[model samples]
Target: MSAYLQAKVVRSRGLCVLSSIGKSVLNRDLWLVTVGDATVPYYPDPESPSTAYPKPKFAYIGGMHGDEIGNVQLLLQFLEEVCTAPREARLQALVDSTVLYIVPCMNPDGYVQLTRLNANYKDLNRNAYSSAFPYARPTTRDATIRNGYGTPLHPEAAWFLTAGGAAMEPETVAVTSWLAAVRPTVSADLHGGALVASYALDACDSKGSINDCPSVEAPLPNLLANAYSMNHKGMRVQLDDTYGDGDFVNGTTEGASWYTALGTLQDWAHHVQHLHMITLEVHSDKQPFGRQLAVLYSLNRDSLLRLAEMAHLGLKARVVDAVSRAPLLAHVELLEPKGMWPPEVEADGLIWKVAVPNMRYSGTLTPVDPGNPDARYPPISFNFTLAASWDEVVSGTGLQGLSAVYTMRARQARRK
Candidate 1:
């Protein structure tokens, strides 16, 4: 890992470091490589004084399930490609506009032992706070012996469950801290066991029935999943009805509808962090080597690039006080296209609304008044119903890009 980082990442001007890992784990250094130019300033956040512009941030995580070696290798290869192939125009534009964080392996102990559990025998994927069945006291044999149970007793389990009062594992702590600090706009968690891209709502009711609950941030995930599957040679074409009568169309599933995966990383990222995240189950084989590696990379290279480019997709703008012109942490909501909701305003008073390409949306923004010491704005919220027709939002060029600074004004007082 160090050799690869020095040779490819460091030399290529990408930032690479051992973000965090377990002390007792064999390979304790979990590598975090970031590729992008922050100076470009794609979109600035007003609330965060540290950064002038909060560039669209995207995260690609792999090897959470340690035995899924292919997951890790794919990301490593992607990172190297991004670093070494700087001359690629499309890739360069993406790096300039967005910040990419790649975590090759999240569970080194599991990778070393070729097991799904970490050194503490905890399934890191099922240990997050968003997990429906978080690690508690043991009841079943799988929980106690195989470490399949969701119990916070394990140090590793505790770490990932930091949001839920679990002990912080060094590895989990590193990722949580980084995410909190960076606050990525989108993320993809890579895993294995199937060849499909799955989206959030991984867990269901207590009865364990599939949730099938649609996600508000569905457009971005659907766009990403389609990109990944369509780019792959055979992924889009379903060969067999393995997942109940052609369940996955175009290589994407709604997660819980396919299977109940409580406490998954993607769910935690979406619900808790309010980030558009998906789980990419890349290969049928957990470990692909030699020719298979090249073939896999070829299948998804363009798709990866396209996914990164999606950072600029949808609607983005800054919501500020109309009088003071100062950034305001506003509440932005989408009333139209019922299932999708807008992400909360960033520290810089910026809000991003992810929507389908051709669809119209009705959005509302309520900015907090700066002069008001109580932090309360007049009840006059700004409501905008844009794109009454597909042509309005999608021009001849397609998906008309919207980037502007919206100066919100408080309701004017009526004169007597």
Candidate 2:
């Protein structure tokens, strides 16, 4: 573990360190540091006063590739700045309004060895669950015996493909389990070797070629990518002549459009977890320290805070009982204009529906059985129709700071 990371863990007010499933090959502790509203429970306890509401959750993950030192360093720097600068009003407001989970280094073993893969010689980026390589087997163990000369097979790949008995890699299980538990509204996995914000659908279809599959959560990533690129000076300009048109328009690209890969974290988060996640390729170099680190942090400071605020960019509300005034664990269904899919419902009764800044959509709040034995209320089915124009929900101009918490009341279920 880096001394800097340890120091941050000590000094940061809301720091929670979670140990990865297994120690690194060198036996170093792989830590996931979460900062912000530490008291917020992962799930609402029915026995306790329900604090669950439509607050946005955001995740920032880095160091999936061991050699991507810049990715990890940038996240650490962000954490330090936010923790140390308590008087910074913007950051404090963000913390107050949203829950931020950060996994600073997902591949500590690879980082220690200065390799892209872990000690098992598997690329963690390719270890996630994806539709393209659903049944892919682990070749790392086999490759080791073949003098390390074969296709890489991550432990996660093996576990998913195996019929009945296999375990996921320690790091993979750690991050995946955490994400599934928290279920952030938006997340970004940092990377190096490129300078563009990459959006989801990182893998091709079952046929194995790149397809222009657009995500239903496209607007959120688009807004996030633009915020990062536009805020950073010179990021929008293309200095590298080798890439397309020498410049990334506002520094963003679709993942599969850039290159097809199977089992990437961003795709897994979007497809499996139903979260809006993106891969942020911060810089072209794998490692940049000291002065370079300062420059990187300075450039991305505002963008980082802005992205956190993006969670409030949509319509948010809580579903409650009509007479009892108790929170009801319910499903929010968005009936958008033709051809758009509805957003996923949260585990809590909180509903957050992402709409374009000025678009119109109809939403329905349907109360269903929460299925938890400790739940405050029993499952009842009733629909409350809702219609809203973005203009009504948004408080002001520019979608960044808009937030509304409407308390929707459901009618009692009539006996048939």
Candidate 3:
């Protein structure tokens, strides 16, 4: 796998990057292939979410369930396709606007054993913890809010989240730690064993609705699920052979609504990382076979690209001190959210959240470090009209009449 990724780096003339995020349970390298820019790409370090990324960082991760090999194969194929695509191709444009981070397999131990659980018999999918369930205190994420997350909804939930939290597997630790550094704007956790796109990972709603989306930020997450389902050839039309995972409204379901998942990577990305994450179950069988695999790849081709495209459509801005002009860590939230805002994104003042295109979204920015200790600094409120395309952000085409001085570039207002 390392050889293939490294070879692609050479093939693409420095457009591709191959790096190991961390080691797996069996000490196998958890490799990540970054597809973008001819200039050697800058990898983000922890606590550095700066304008180093003028474009959105998007990731497609697969193989949480070692048995779900199709997801792994599909992502590998995607990397090949994009790397070989012509410089002027649509794939290049998509790459131009978004930094594509593709991790072909997250659980090599499970994959080698052809099992759902890792070598330790723990399900990697059930090993992620969300920091913002009962929600979190915006001022400091010194600790995860544990009000309602300590209990197990089912026996499977105990694999990770419970009264006695299990130790995180190496693969789980590798993923969580890597995410902190990359700080992707969007992510798709690809899976098999079913055929549908699911989002809003909370297992239940605030009003006790089972498997419903339980975030104040449901609209954008739902849009992510819809983008995959609507784009797939039969995700919305064909029902899965066994699990009945498909043929839903628009081929998308609220995750945990279709079925409950505890400590999944998607939920952690959404709640803890303040990212718009969705799970894509692209096949009916856990292990796909035969020529149908090619057909399946064809099914998700457009959705894969469109998902990255959506990242560019949302709220893209940066928060900085008016005096020192330094980036200020801030929590960006919708103005009239139905519930508490998702956890604060640890970025270098730059924030990009999925939003409805052509619609007006009122939002607020609460700085983590107010410049003046003597004076009171209240959350600054602002509004903007989202564009239908990513051109606004990619070209640094200037602002959308923003009230706050948020230049959507690495140096923020340098383009101004």
Which candidate comes out best when scored by lDDT? 3
Pairwise lDDT winner, candidates 1 and 2: 2
Cα RMSDs, all models: 6.6, 6.9, 8.5
lDDT of each residue in 1-416, candidate 1, tens digit only: 65776677656754433344233245477777777754456533344333334567778888888898887888888887787754576676667667888888888778888887777766777656533233232223322232357543333223333322344455566666677677776678888778887787675443224447667666557666665666666677744436543388777777777766556667767666766777888888898889998887887676666556555555566555555556666676767767666645776665665556656666566666445646555444344433323223222221124222234444323444
Task: Give the lDDT of residue 378 in candidate 2.
Answer: 35
Q: Which ten residues in a row have the lowest lDDT in candidate 3?
A: 396-405
User: Which regions of candidate 2 deviate over 4 angstroms?
Assistant: 14-27, 38-54, 131-168, 206-208, 239-247, 337-341, 368-400, 413-416
Q: Between candidates 1 and 3, which one is better according to TM-score?
A: 1
Checking candidate 3 for backbone clashes, the offending pairs are 49-348, 51-410, 128-263, 211-256, 211-257
Give residue 282's lDDT in candidate 3 (0 to 100): 89
lDDT per residue for candidate 3 within 1-416, as digits (tens), equals 77877887778776678889989878888888888752433323223344343566788889988899998888877887888747546676677656889899998888888998877777777676555654321211212333376642243333334321455788889988988788777788888877778887645522222455555676667777776777777886744334324235677777766665666777777767767788988887788767877887898877787776665556556655565555566666766443535323443455655565555667676665545443334677767666454223322222232111234211223322
- For model 2, residues 1-416, the per-residue Cα lDDT tens digits are 56776677677754434345345556666666665664554322233235356457888888889998997888888888766645476676676657777778888888877888877776777767544344343343432332255533332334323321234466776788878888887788888887777777765553224445667665655666665666666565634434333235567766666665556788778777777777888878888888998888887776666666666655566666677666666754565644445645666566665556555656555665454334343343322223434333322223333543355565566644
CA error at residue 120 for candidate 2, angstroms: 1.1
lDDT of all the models against the reference?
0.62, 0.63, 0.66
